[model samples]
Target: MSTLRMAAVSAPFGRDLEEDFARIGALIEQARGDGVGLLVLPEACLGGYLTDLDGAAELPPAFRVGGPEIARLAGLAGDMVVCAGFCETAGAKTYNSAVCVTGDGVLGVHRKVHQPLREDASYAAGDRFTAFDTPVGRIGMQICFDKAFPEAARAQALDGAKIVCSLSAWPTSATNRHPDPAQDRWTRRMDLFDRARALDNQLVWVASNQFGAFGAMRFAASAKVVDPGGEIVAWTEQREGLAVAEFDVDAVVDAARGGMDFLRDRRPDTYPATGGTPYVAA
Candidate 1:
């Protein structure tokens, strides 16, 4: 039976490797008890996040790309693939990148494509798309704002990803409040990208986010698992606890084979990649 149980972590940004490792330890313990095979956490997890530190001399010096932080989290989980966000230093530039790790070792990494306002000022856009084979099924990762872009997730689907996991540090958006008619409309349009990717592609879209506030930056903590049909399976509105769910790889495979085959109906004839219009742009 092809199955992948996953955990989405949501907490404030931790300071150094020790702090991150401690959280990873707690995450591992929870995952172990839940029998989860995969764990996805928030963005910039290793290095603490603050819009003020764009070029302020890599604070800890220990916070470089593929630094000891990577090994620490990788070693923490015995047999699970963990996706975490951290700063990636290439040449003299720093990128908002996510590290993909498994039981054996790191399975490549992806830099964030579409960064926020301050993010673009700080991070260089990532050029590639990452899709890899996992014991559960083919999986992919795109962080925060990347989920708002269609192509980011669609590209993964095209790459044969049955499950696409998004690790985010989504700041609290005014539109995502108590569901009123107007709020409802706004929410759908906003989350439409996430839903479209899942429903249209017939793939599971796991949106794990860092909820609550890290000083001034706040995450909605609205992390949830959207099924292939675009229906949310399990999630949380507040960023306090952990959300865990067991998914059947067979179901995902079967779903992608049915009605909404986003991959099959691709208009590669006219359109380019899955990335469409900018969500924030009017």
Candidate 2:
């Protein structure tokens, strides 16, 4: 298999559509120069994330999946496979969504299924987890809080995803704040989730997050690429930059699963079914 160069971005984006596109264009040019074949941008990189998680925070502008914005994004992507987040609207409903694209147009899309804090007040929950084919490999996408759930990544892996891109606008702890954003507990949790999910599913993990501050929220920008063995291959720790890594996706994933084969040794039959009554000690 050919070596694939991928990057996860840690940069700030705001409510200004033109400003956001300018930033994105510059990043794409940078990635192109770095020979990146796959690029994952931060969640809500299109417009911006909520100012506060409180239900009162004004929502970002919503766009259609097939709107001009995505078309412009695809044009910027050209031949490169790019995954980015945006506020998507379908009729009266708005979703925190991610889309994968190239010059050929969209490859796949994922609506955020999990909502943290008061996020539900801003966007509707997604229904399912699915992986799709891309130039790099079979890729799956999940937004911010979705990575915390084991089932989310597990479902993608089960559906043949070799790489999972997690886009986040995750912020610092609301309470017990740390002076340095890097030292914050929420930042640690974000990193932990990336590593844990990669190890659990034995696939390549790429994570992108917002940098700097937006509204009352200060984001934790720890973008990274983790190997199937749960090792950090490349990272941009608490800063604005790109975490770039190059490797043969199939080779690494196969080698990781060769030993234990976590996916092959499942015992789903013994697992409790939905709504199954719990056993009580006598």
Candidate 3:
């Protein structure tokens, strides 16, 4: 299929695993009804996010990646592709992870690379960035703060990701919470990052974020689907809903990169060779 319908979600998730899965099922069914071939959900969609970054007492228990929860999610995914975030428990360590699944089984997974502030206290970070082939297309997944750094998305782009799904549980600035969370500086940064990342790599971007309040944090839900030209084709600005868009994946990418290939035009050899402090990868 040249043109594929996609849906990106902006919704609140809590510690109630059953409720979360129910909501996910509803969203997936809704997307399927809307003829969506792919659906992207927010980070921590499986379980609620941390109450606050200032060291919360208790966090949602981590789940094994190959456990029943992921299997149920995969079953619900059916034919349509789904990408959602969960706290992944591997051995004794837990990491913030995003998994892509279909009716058949797991497609790919990404452990968040960049942890902001006190996030490290809750979860381990991922060591690398990779793009993998999904039923929809070659895509990459990145969690919240990961989008802030140009390298994260670029790494996926260089690895042949035509589409990047960014799942975030982002919130308004704790110090200066804007009366309108949508207008907050952090929200602006999120928007800028989405567009910049899409434009920089000249690829399609699907950004899904959390909405509403959880503990002391209130999210700025700005889920959106950006075209290869860095324009929002569909968006839910601070609202809890799905932003839907359709595109002939390959055609869109080709048209945006026809004359100028951003990937090919890179001069990585001359870029600041002086290595400073490298980001800690999980």
Candidate 4:
């Protein structure tokens, strides 16, 4: 298929796993009915997200990567490619992870590399960023804070990821509050980062974010599907719904890069080293 129909969802998910699955199943079916071949769900959709950041040692729910929950998700995936997040248990350490799955099985898994706030207290940080092949295309994933770092998405771009699914539970700044999510600084940053990352890498960007309130945090639900040109084709601004868009992946990428191939034209040799490098004018 040259053109792939995709859906990015903005919805609230909590501690109830059964309820979560029901909601996910309904979303998947809804996307399927809309002729979507790929579906991207928000961060911590399976086991929900952290409610108390500064609390005690009690852990949030974590499941093994090869556990029954993933198997159930794989079964639900059916013919459509589904990307969703969960708290992953690998041995004794648990990481905030996202998985790409279809009827065949789990295609790829991304353990979120960047942890913000008290997230580190809950889950171990991932050490690497990698992209893998999926049914629709070569894809990469980044969780919440991961997208804030340009290197995270750039690494995937370097690995030849045509599409990047960024799952986030992003909320407004605790210090600065805006009545409208569209005017909120955090939401603005999220939207800007989404467009900039896509345009910077020249790749299709599928952004999904958690909606509604979780404790003191009120999530900014601006789920969207952005083209390589940094244009949002479809979006759900502070609402619980699906943002769907159709793309001929190759054609879109080709058109975007035809004029200026950022990856190919990159001058890595001129780049300074990380950690207190003197700024040099290019």
Candidate 5:
């Protein structure tokens, strides 16, 4: 893969799963027609987000791992790689997870390592992260609020991920941004955390967030593709729209090691995770 053309589709939320999914199908087809090789949808696009999301038992069992929900989208990859935000039930716990699907089948599932501050009332926090090799580039995902934690991005970058795509439903509130502190503030501190992650990690980043109002929740975060150099290559309006960008794999290398060499001068010896203590965002 010489270059990566990423597309993010921002659609409805909550009870509009089927409709949004159908819209995504059309978007994928349209993108393919326009020569798009990599496509991504908004966060929790399957079960919907920030409203009254039902428990794991309500979803069809087949959609669990090898289910119809996964199959439906898997069948859409016409020689292109597809990633969508969806719900996952592993063991007795359910998580807000995402899957990467190749044209052949499901390549891998990424359990979001870091969860939102108020996410405890919903999905259980995932303890792992996964990065996979793709035809376009090495890719990894950190759903929504996961971008706020530098360690979450660092963990993936250290594992050989040149690019990271985060499916988010950022809030429109202030103070705690990126759905942190359990507040609805996507529009308030929208770019602060995202830009920090891209600039510090030096990897191509796609932060696709939800839009429109569903029930009492409204997601205003725009879709953006940030370069490894911390510069936003493409960003959509704070309200709604689709964002697309073409990223060369080499750009990430140059940004991370060249003039934007922030990671190289880090003093890791001074900071260590001595205990498994939970992190609290202020």
Candidate 6:
């Protein structure tokens, strides 16, 4: 498929597995009706995110990567390639993970490597970034705070990912509350990161975030689809909606990199091997 119809969702999910599946089913049916081949859902859409970033909040129930929950998700996905976040279990360890699936079964899985605030207290960190083949394209996955780091996305890009899906459960400022969520600093940062990552990697970027309030957290529902040129083609700004767009993925990526290829002109050799010393005035 040359032209891919894709969507990034901004919707709320919670602790109830049944309720979450209901919401997910409805979203998938809606996307199928719209002929979307790739659907990206918010982080923790399976079991919900931490009630609060503080260490005191209870962790969500964890399911194995090959567990029945993922199988159910795959069955629901049918022909559409869907990506959603969930709490994954591996024996004694639990990871905040994202999985890509279809009726055919799982395509890719990413355990979010970066944890924000006190998140580390609840879940163990993932060690690697990987991109895998899917019906839609070569896709890389990242959770909320992972996108804040350029290296995370770059690693995937370098590994031959053509599209990146960023699933987020990001919330607005916990302390400095903003009357309008659209103007919140955290919301602004999320949007900036989405665009910057797309432009920096010259790949299609689909960002999905949680909407509404869950416990003490108020989410920033700025889900969007950004082109390789760093332009937001579709956005659900501060609302619960699906940001959808159709484009020729290869064509746009080629166009973006044609004039001045960011990846082609690399200076990795000049950069420090490890964290370089802080620059001092000469």
- C-alpha TM-scores of all predictions: 0.84, 0.96, 0.95, 0.95, 0.84, 0.96
For every model shown, the clashing-pair count is 2, 0, 3, 0, 9, 0
RMSD per prediction, one decimal? 5.5, 4.7, 4.0, 3.8, 5.8, 4.6
Q: Highest lDDT among the candidates is held by which one?
A: 2
Error of 4 at 80 (Å): 0.6
Off by over 4 Å in 4: 55-58, 272-282
Ranked by lDDT, the better of candidates 1 and 5 is 5
Error of 4 at 35 (Å): 0.7
For model 5, how does the per-residue alpha-carbon lDDT over 31-125 read when each residue is reduced to its tens digit?
A: 78768787777777776775533232233221486887788788877588888888787778777788888768887687766655556556777
Q: Across residues 1-282, which tens digit of lDDT does each residue of candidate 2 receive?
A: 799999999999999999999999999999999999999999999999999998988989899999999999999999999999999999889999999999999999999999998999999999999899998889999999999998899888888888999999999998998999989999999999999999998999999999999998999999999999999999999989999999899989889887787777776657745212232111
Off by over 4 Å in 1: 52-65, 174-191, 272-282
Considering lDDT, where higher is better, how would the candidates rank from best to worst?
Answer: 2, 6, 3, 4, 5, 1
lDDT of each: 0.69, 0.93, 0.90, 0.89, 0.70, 0.92
For candidate 5, the lDDT comes to: 0.70
Q: Model 4: per-residue lDDT, tens digit, 128-246? A: 87889988999999998888998788888888788999998888877769988889999999999999999998899999999999877799999999999999999998899999999
Please identify model 5 stretches exceeding 4 Å from their true place. Answer: 52-62, 174-185, 274-282
Against the correct fold, how does model 5 do in TM-score? 0.84
Q: Least accurate stretch of 10 residues (summed lDDT) in model 3?
A: 273-282
How many steric overlaps does candidate 4 have? 0
> After superposing candidate 2, which stretches have Cα over 4 Å from the reference?
274-282
lDDT (0-100) at residue 217 of candidate 4?
73
